[model samples]
Target: MNMLKYPTLLTALCVSTMLLAQKAKPVKQGNKSHTDVATVEYLPEFTREVPAESGSVFKIKNKRYNLEIRLWDQKKVRIVSTVPMGSDTDTLTNDELYKMSGVTLSAFGKRIDLASDEYPENRVAEVTNIQVQGLPAQPAKNRQDANGAEEIVVEGYKTTTKKQQANVGEVTVVGYKKGGTDSSGKTPSAFPNRPVKDEPASIYGTQNPQVADVVVTGYKSTWTRTSSTRRNMVVYIPRDCKLVVDNRYTDIVVNEDLDKAEFTLYRSNLGLRNVNELRVDASFYTMYAGNLGYADLKLASGSLTAGTIDNAQIESTGSEVEYEGGNTLFLKSKADRINVENVGSVGGYKEFGELRIGKLSQDLTLEGKSTHVKIRQITSEVTAIRISTQFADLRLPLKQLTGYDIDFKGDNSTVYSSFEKKEMNANAGIANSESLVAAGVTFGNKAPAAFHVKSDESAGKKTSFNITCNNCTVDFK
Candidate 1:
């Protein structure tokens, strides 16, 4: 039967006529929500033998079928595909399903490629038009005033004058004039008494508060989110066989262990646990992993949540990473946020955003244009921290730290540390950026100037902090 009978299903199933010739049984699927039933059909299996000298490593390249590929301990390469047809159509022949599927499978010389020209209905994605929402306009209110005299005396201030009342008052002007101290003349000051000298403000490090997430008027914000249908395929591959996958719009899950895997994904989803080496090139790459080692990711956006990464090299437009521990991380980004509970070390260059580390056990070397860094605790094991940034803020724990060294060169920047105002320019009492980050409070300075603060903790541990910044603030308290 033509696919028009099932408009929801974009194309026919994949069933060859050769298999339908024997004991053909039309299986029916129960209707769940709508008038739709399905019949399962397994396509012809494709396999290739590995050469004895070629090391039994199968290479798979797939651009179709959002399949779950599991690495298994198999002798050779094998691929199988299944599709569901409308069970109501018994008269529908197998030849029609095979032609509509456009299946293409080739396995030769340790290389296997399985794909199809046509995809199921669920492979299609739907995106809504760009929507713009804005705040409503506010009407202006009319101003009002109470009726009163033009030069009337206020409650506290009354008119004062010395007059010679000898009936010459008609010619001399002295009826009333504004004057007064308070009801009591003992105070020479005005009725307000100068406002009680103003108390000093208590704030350190960043002077700029975190801007709320608000869109101002006259700004047109247009955005859209893409969604995928629930349709997928399943594929089985040999265990630990090196894999190379590419460009598609589907969810890929590598369930078993893999020694090495490389992928180029666009508008796709991927998930894995342990991988010896993984290289990915994607548009919006988002993944969750545990114990992932040796990863190289270059993408437009990266949102990774991992347990530990032994080594990584990431270059992206934006990032939101939260990891437990890592050996070494190197990255470059425009705007990103990186939070590690504990790590051996971290090194990167960020154009904007924030970096937070709960407890660092090793060294931290960073360079940024405008990135606020908040480190909760720099362990004694950490020998040194080197930073360079502008229009940003840095906070460290100095009150809790023992003896340490600090070499700071701030060009038009402010330092808020020492227990006193002059001590804000002092050293060794406060931290770098761990001031109030946990409460969603961030900071930055608008102006900068030349200033330097140094400390010598020659007796305690050999920990040190060296920073050079412009228009920034360093808070150690």
Candidate 2:
């Protein structure tokens, strides 16, 4: 009996030791430090107080799955997942369900990466097309079925419709209440002749005025036309009011500071202008502004020319946009052309388009495929510039390069620059191309100014100008 007991005890001890070894083992990830998740512990919920930086990538993982979230330009977020078929498909645990909810995935400051140790694979998920959330809703697509019946298919799950109309001579003002009050606690009138007492109070009270008011001028007896036609007129708008303009066939012109007001516009053709924050969505129209404030402009096959903007977000399809001064600019376009003279901070995604920029005061970022870019100058205030492209050519003509750190990586491509050969640290034959090259240059004549350049290498907490191109040419002068 004693011998049997001793054998049983030894077997029990061996089994416990095996279990401990399995739990302690770590799984390796690609280039990253290994994490041990064999114990299967749940992580605390993540809180994203600030917006993630544009173009940053984040990851979320559970016991049996991994999900990647990429923040695209214009508040768009793309989510992709990796889980074997039929693996944890049903009966998901509480932690697994939360990981897939996307509630913790904030779309706007730095990258957030969270992982579980239970599942470890060195695989970088294959690039497959995925839909992104928060992009401008596309128009319904027309399709013909097998029975030859026409069908309209809308792509988005949510839709909103707003409509406003004004008679031939009367002016209409749609203004949000938040902008109606100044710092002095006064409710200003939206129009010149309209009195503050006559204007209706916002239905949405003072806390959060999501509701807007529509004030219309008295109808004129002389202007009694049924059909809408373009009329030349001048309009005044409130300094801090939000304005929304939607027109089909109107040519608009905005004048700069004709009056003592914040902005003034003299419209030779029928169009709406003025207000503090402006948003315009037009088709088949031409708009010109001398000096602009913050605006969100969307166009479909038209042109908009502006002189200056504090902050501007532009989205266009087959349109042309030209602006001179901008502090922060976000552009999203397809088959469109954008020309800007001076910008403080600019970043966006463009496809099959052309971008011509004169000078960058801060940083410029581009991420897209098959686009041509030309940048004239990089100012001393620039912190970092990053461009990732495929099948695109980039040209930069630098006025001076004393304060920049440059990195260029190309596959099946060439890098041509006028900088002295000694300034570059180049390596040939990188990943996929025999002619691939990685070049690094730190500008400055004296001791390099604590600046460093990296090519085909990671940039950690450093201000850099990083360019990655495939099947393209990068030229610097």
Give the number of the best model, judged by lDDT.
Answer: 1
**Candidate 1 — which residues are off by over 4 angstroms?**
1-64, 84-100, 118-227, 399-401, 419-458
Per-residue lDDT over 136-207 for candidate 2, one digit per residue giving the tens place of the 0 to 100 score: 223222111111111111111111112122211112121111223434554443332222222222322222
Q: Which tens-of-lDDT digit does each residue in 338-363 have in candidate 1?
A: 78787787888988888888888888
Candidate 2: clashing residue pairs, number = 6
Q: Candidate 2 local accuracy as lDDT?
A: 0.45
For model 2, give the 10-residue run with minimal summed lDDT: 218-227
Highest-scoring model, TM-score: 1
At residue 469, what lDDT does model 1 achieve? Answer: 81
Worst 10 residues of 1 by lDDT: 207-216
TM-score of each: 0.58, 0.41
